[model samples]
Structures are given as structure tokens and as C-alpha cells.
Target: MVSIKEGNSPDTETLILEAARKVFIRKGYDGARMQEIADEAGINKALLHYYFRSKEKLFDQIFLAAFKDFWPSIKSELEQGDGSVKCLIRAGVNAYTDMLMKTPYLPAFVVSEINRSPERMEGLLQASGVDAAFVMAVVQRGIDRGEVLPMDPRSLLINMLGLVLFPFISRPVLSRLFFDSEEAFMSFVGQRRQEVYAFMCRAVLHSSAL
Candidate 1:
């Protein structure tokens, strides 16, 4: 039942899930096969079916885990404030960007699956209880206090997500076109904290602060 434990152990369920995530990322929903997942997990198709029943069921389990893993980091990061709106936004953006970098395929997987499966998309929305309002309210406070410009809160949140997430979503093209190597690509992304902070500041901060 526990999926956190990795490596060779008696936890067939966890081993299956771990293997399935890798296969899903590598092959995607359309390309991923149950046999491939079972092979990756070092188990036969029969054993894999015993636990997951079907590729669709296996996907649902992985998708749920993926969405569940993402939200908490966002909530924790957005909730922090370092006494300045610039710093607060910076912290949140950095945390989110870093999380995406750590899990490179997650954004792409989500983007792809959302377009391919309407039912899976609904499941993702239901499973992921991410509160956009928290970020909106925090940014709104800055606008209210005249610390930020009177931009629409929704636009601000969307812009923040785009700035941080877009790079990850388009990593293959970005890396191939601009970056010389994988390390360089990662280094470029790593530098986006200040870049995004500056972008947000110029967009919303009219004329103030460090």
C-alpha cells in the first residue's frame, strides 16, 4: 500500500507505482503499456494486473499522486512572506520553479494528459485541491496597500504560473534551441528567480523597492 519506499523490497504495490511513473513519463499515456510497466517493475503482467487491474487504473493512481505531490509545495511557498511583497513573490516563484525543475516531466505530463483525456482532466481537477485564491489574496493585499499596481489579480497569478512553468513545459525546445548542454539549460532555469522577480516588479511595482 505504501508507495514511498523505493528499492528492492517486498512492497509490490510501491514498486509497481514507482515503475509505472517512470514508464508513464518515458512513454506517456498513449505509448505506455501495462507490460512495459510490469517489466519495469520486475513483475509479470499478471502480477501488475492483480494490483492495478488496468493501464487506465494505473494511470489514475499515478496522476493522483502527481497532483497531490504538487499542491502542498505551492501552498507552503505562497504562505511565506519575508516582510516585502517582492521577497514574498520571489520566494514563492523560486519554490515553484525549483519544484518543476526537480520533476521535469510533471508539467509536460499534465499538459499532455489534460488535452488527451477529458475524464482524466476532470479527475486531475478534483484530485488537486490547489487554491488559487490564496495566491490571489496575497497579491491583492499588496495592491490594496499600494505596494503593487492595480493590475487584475487573476492576470497576476496566471502570469506568475506562466513565467515559472512555461520554461519547464517547453524545456525540450528551449534546451535544444538555446542551451549548449543540459547543465547550461538547467543553469538558465536556475537564474529565473531574479528574472521573474524583476518581471513581476516591473509589471506591478510601478516605482519601488528591492
Candidate 2:
């Protein structure tokens, strides 16, 4: 086990973070212990503390890192492009769904932890800088451009996200409901990845046409 040394290589921080991410994903935040993280990092618990003061702090770093990874694609899509609202929505939908697929445990972890600590949600919201207003502006632009049918932007955004996220979040139940076994459900999900994008595009186009 190689330990991360201080006053030397900054690359060691990345190693610690990668190790912590693995442990957290495997054991979950609540189930993960400091000693486990230390062992995974190949460092002493004291050194772990030196890098990240507490379990909560370490988890926060992981959470923020995950959030940043998820957020930038959508934000960049919005800020860039030719100001095509439909394109923005499509890009955002793809980015968000892709992130969810890559990090399936993310939603469950964030939602559960936020539920336990309501105040944390506010900080997260502020940090992400994504609120109802921003989503609504995107939807409103689509409406103005006659690219989407008239509807409450908030409701539309919610519905879109729900359609994309609920299936993944409830994969176990959804799998059982629609398929005979877990394997079948996963296969279904793999197929639905494309289906979801197509469905979303059609739904938005249909709404705009109406």
C-alpha cells in the first residue's frame, strides 16, 4: 500500500480522491468508515484526516465533484450553440441522462443525504446555479421559437427529468414490473437509453406543433 506523502506531489490528492470515491461507492457514505478509506488510500487515518478533516468533509468533496461533472455539460450546451432552444433541451437531456447512466448511485446518494440534511440542499442548489428559473427560460425560448408546444416550463422540465431519471432510480422495481428478471430489466434499460432520447424529442416536437 503506497501512502500519499505531504509537501511533495499534488498528484497524491487525486489518488486519495479516487480511492475515496471507490470506497464510498462500494460501501456508501453511511456504511463507509474512515479506516476503510484510509486503507483504500494506502495511507494512515491521520493522513486521511490531514487531507480531509472529516467523513462529512470528504463526502462533501465527492458530492461537489460529482455535481460539477454532471452540471458542466448542460451548462455549456446552454451557453454555447446557436441559441436554438430545442437543441439546448436536447443537449441537456442527453447530457443529464448520460451522467445518470455513468453514475447510477449518484441520485440515490444525493437524494437520501439531502433528505437527512435539508440545509445541504440549499447549498447544493446555489452551487449548481440551476434553478426553476433557468430551466423555465430554456423552455420559454423553445416556446417563443415555435419549437415546442405551449406548456408550463417547470412542469415540462419536471416531466422530462422524471421520465429520464425515474426509470433508472426505480430500475429494480421497474425491471420486475416490466420484465421477468433483473437481467431482462437491465437489457431493457440498455435499449431505453436510445428510446428515451427519441421519445423526448418526439414529445417536445409534438408539443411545439400543438
The candidate scoring highest on TM-score is 1
TM-score of each: 0.86, 0.78
Top lDDT model:
1
lDDT digits (tens) for residues 53-147 of candidate 2: 78889888987776566453576766676665566656766787778768866666665666667787778878876556666776788777787
- Model 2 reaches what TM-score against the true structure? 0.78
> How would you encode candidate 1's per-residue C-alpha lDDT over 80-137 as one tens digit per residue?
5554567667776877777776797788877777678766655566668666666677
Residue clash pairs of candidate 2? 148-208, 149-207, 149-208
Global lDDT scores for all candidate models: 0.77, 0.72
Model 2: per-residue Cα lDDT at residue 105: 62
Clashing pairs in 1: none
Question: Model 2 scores what on Cα lDDT?
Answer: 0.72
